[model samples]
Target: MKSISKYWSIFQITLINSLAYPGELVGRSLMIIPFMWIFYQLWKVTFSAAGAADGMINGLTLRDTLWYLMLAETIELGRPPIARTMSENVKDGSIAYILNKPYDFLLYQFSTAMGETIFRAMLNAVFGGLTVWWLVGTPNHPEGFLIALPAIFGAWILHFSINAMIGLSAFVVEDVSAFTWIYQKLAFIFGGMLIPLDFYPQWLQNIAKLLPFSSAIYGPARLFVTPTLELFISVMSLQITWIIALTFALAIVYRRGLAQLTVNGG
Candidate 1:
């Protein structure tokens, strides 16, 4: 463990590698174009049928909902497949080399993930924004975006920590596929991916907010579309809290997993 700079360099390398396939990155980002249209039609039809007083549903205008989805997918689509990566490393004895390195293995893993994630996340966010512009024009909540900046950064940290926890669980579970799938569903339903939390029943919304899933995905998107200073403070505070808690939990899991490692020595 030399210093933070060492792992930061690893982060830089990972970021550079992600840019190696700029075309592929742009292509993958196009996935959001259709996503925006589908949701746009769905909301448009739903709102037309709802025929509410002001084209609003459950406290959100259709425009607000679409932007929420855009922000959510920006974070969601950028996620790396770390569970399999971690499992492969553990199975192939690569974990041994990683643990012996000067920089902290956990820090190195997180740095690399963040580095690569920034590339993908930036692309996804830009594409998603463009889709929003083409479909709905400028964001209705411009002020909300200013507050969302810190919230989005916090959410990214929380997102990485949650995935890192799943990956590090390779020590306890041979496979993390089931866990990741279940978590993804939770994120879709509770993290307000498929829809915003406001659409949910009051009790269900409470449960969603209580989970880290919401803090990771919904918190940032929610802050961007709904701009109350109180809410901005609340979501950012919760995101920071979850980031600390999840990072600590990941450290504990890694320490235990490292201690459990056995060598085949004469």
Candidate 2:
């Protein structure tokens, strides 16, 4: 009870703080507008070129693909710079202050992120829905909203942990931009950000399925469009498993990182 309350306070504080900087959320969502437009045109051209080859490229029409793209964009944009901030804190010794706090530093981070993510997700859905309506008039599968909720939450957990792990790497490497960049690209490519993983070669699909990247953006967004009981269970299960494993991995990393910290002046 106390723990929940304590984190609840952090969550509330972060939520209010986000309002102070309303532009960030709006700006981030707005920035995706142009990109979404570009994708719309590109996909339209591609589908036109495909021209009766098949309406389903890896179980996606032009419309379904656009919907999937919106979800993917939202997830990617909604992520706060957990890795960047943590890496900078570690580099500058500011993590000392965070460590001195009563709550777990990672939990504190997660709570703050959750607040921001909730706000962003709501706004992103609105903006994305508008954008999709403008371009393609209802991207299909309205029922997916329900099926995707748990999967998206699970993806958020996995994303947070993966980023925390990258941030913790700063303890040894001191700079993690390269790592983050690579991770983002891999998530974009293998995670099915640009397109569906099913369109990829069988070998690539196998590799992507094995990685958490697939579970995060790809799997959840895929769930939003596909929405089958079996697929939902499979995606959610993968997301849950990745959440547990990545969180366990983060615990180990944070433990070691804490041990390595140098605390002196009171």
Q: Please report the candidate that would top lDDT against the real structure.
A: 2
Which pairs of residues have clashing backbones in candidate 1?
Answer: 1-102
Deviation from native of the Cα of residue 171 in model 1, angstroms:
1.3
The alpha-carbon deviation from the true structure for residue 35 of candidate 2, after best TM-score superposition, in angstroms, is 1.2
lDDT of each: 0.83, 0.86
Clashing pairs in 2: none
The regions of model 2 sitting more than 4 angstroms off are 263-266
TM-score of each: 0.94, 0.95
What is the lDDT for 145 in model 1? 75
lDDT of 1 by residue, 112-165 (tens): 777878878888888888888888788888788778888887877787777777
